[model samples]
Target: MTVVVNENRNKRARVASATHVAGCRMDLNVRDFAPMAADEPALAGGTDEGPSPLEYVTAGLAACQLVTVTKIADAMGLDYTGLRVDAEADVKFRAAQGAMSPIPRFSAARLVVRMRSPEPPERLARLEELVEERCPVSNLFLDAGIAPEVVWAIETTG
Candidate 1:
């Protein structure tokens, strides 16, 4: 969520996100744009109308990985026709609830990318390496010593 302010002459990119309570849900607005609702399940006390905060974090990481991979593939001229990314995070519930641990965030995260392409395996591997080095979301976890594991499943299709 980067926005370049061309009129400011500094050419700085900033992300503006705000959230407010909308009944039993939270409405998140980015740059005064589309609003997404974040809610917990009935078991968690709120209506199960939208994804939870942790789920949104996982989704953001997955989406960031996809974008990074796509950019790398495009730069390398890889002809990938199909792409799927699945991401999940393991959080310490006890820590979140102040029951234990040092942090309340994800302890670990994983990403599985399935790609359909005719590109060589070596090229795909290099692309993966680049994505690992460049993805901001992945780096956030990596810098924090979470060290997310990324698995690539490349399948050639006609």
Candidate 2:
């Protein structure tokens, strides 16, 4: 796979393109993946065809965390039968609504990671720490002054 590097030395360049599809709706494509739609809610004059941009951002963070956790677990030889992640974010739309506000678009976010594993508590704690430290999307939230609350719930397995 080809990698593009931006001025930020530690970051890799990722590109996505969007096409406007009527009021508050857009068709977006990333890499070679299937096309996806992004739309605002009906209240925001959209058709509500797909998730809003903010929703996509929140889901991206959750997906990133899950990917990071799975990679780390495999590297650590941690065995798990199942894994799930639930994510939510608090958003302030004043800026998006054409108002100048000091508050950020995403005020905060929460993540609940549930895993069924035979690993010990210490091991699970270590996994959580590493995920928090390594997940790039999570770091993005932090860099934007939004500290995400991450909870790890591990169910011990035989």
Candidate 3:
């Protein structure tokens, strides 16, 4: 019976793994962005300037975790008025204060997940466990040893 229970737990619906790909061409006074995988090669700086593909990756990690947590809460029937996640990076650098690279930054991250569920502390605790377990972004941060903090704040409106 214990074996069956464990197997069933492992059988829960889950999706893991994805392929990220993109390509860029730089040919202007200032480099412009192009689709990583475009049907036709796009001209650089012709389109409106926007975030580089790398920025998209960083945002993806944050947003993916946020959406994953929300989905888990819904699937578990946990009641919550709303939820939001804010993420920022406290990056490393090319060198120390005066090394060399001039990369301006390596990268570190800070994330805050603000949850607005009215469930008792215990229930919220369970949801936290689920998000921690299932959120790819959160797991990535944990596995990578990036410091992330999630907190609850009383909801309010004006």
Candidate 4:
């Protein structure tokens, strides 16, 4: 189904390959992150900050999906700027009835996609639909369970 789009501008999300050793404590890889630009420093801390690897994983789900939404708006010719996903999470043990696990059992992230576009609700909803269709990362978590499965692609090797 071809949705008519005026103004051929586009927005897309890109990622590089990564690796994380299954149970090794030290060698872990992360693919999703905004680089520490000159504007933002790496260290602004008390004991609470500097996201653990799990936090990065959770955040990636939200940010990657929101980028998908942004691309949807762009393709549909919705004049917009400044899209953001404000996400929050809580981690807890799934079956620990009474034990307080010092380590988090699993983390949760609630995504609040902040969008600034001048489109009606129906159109916006359609845009979201298109985004969901196009976003592999979002679909991976939403439709299928988040199990790791690497696929082979015959594209340019980077």
- The lDDT for every candidate, in the order shown, is 0.81, 0.86, 0.56, 0.51
TM-score of each: 0.81, 0.86, 0.57, 0.52
Instruction: State residue 3's C-alpha deviation in candidate 3, in Å.
Output: 17
Q: Which portions of model 3 show Cα errors greater than 4 Å?
A: 1-48, 96-100, 103-107, 154-158
Clash count for candidate 1 is: 0
Q: Candidate 4, residues 70-100: lDDT per residue as tens digits?
A: 6667666776556666645565645544665
* Candidate 1 C-alpha lDDT tens digits along 64-124: 9999888778877789977889998998754334554344468899999988998777877
User: RMSDs, each prediction?
Assistant: 5.0, 5.0, 8.8, 12.3
Off by over 4 Å in 1: 1-13, 22-24, 95-104
Model 4 / residue 59 / CA error / Å: 1.5
Clashing pairs in model 4? none
Which is the better candidate, 3 or 4, if ranked by lDDT? 3
Better of 1 and 3 by lDDT: 1
For model 1 the TM-score comes to 0.81
The TM-score of candidate 4 is 0.52
| Cα lDDT tens digits for candidate 3, 1-158 | 01112566766764433223333422222124333321212433223244444455467667976787777777777777667777665556454456543443425665667766667777667776766667676567667776456554535322
Name the top lDDT candidate.
2
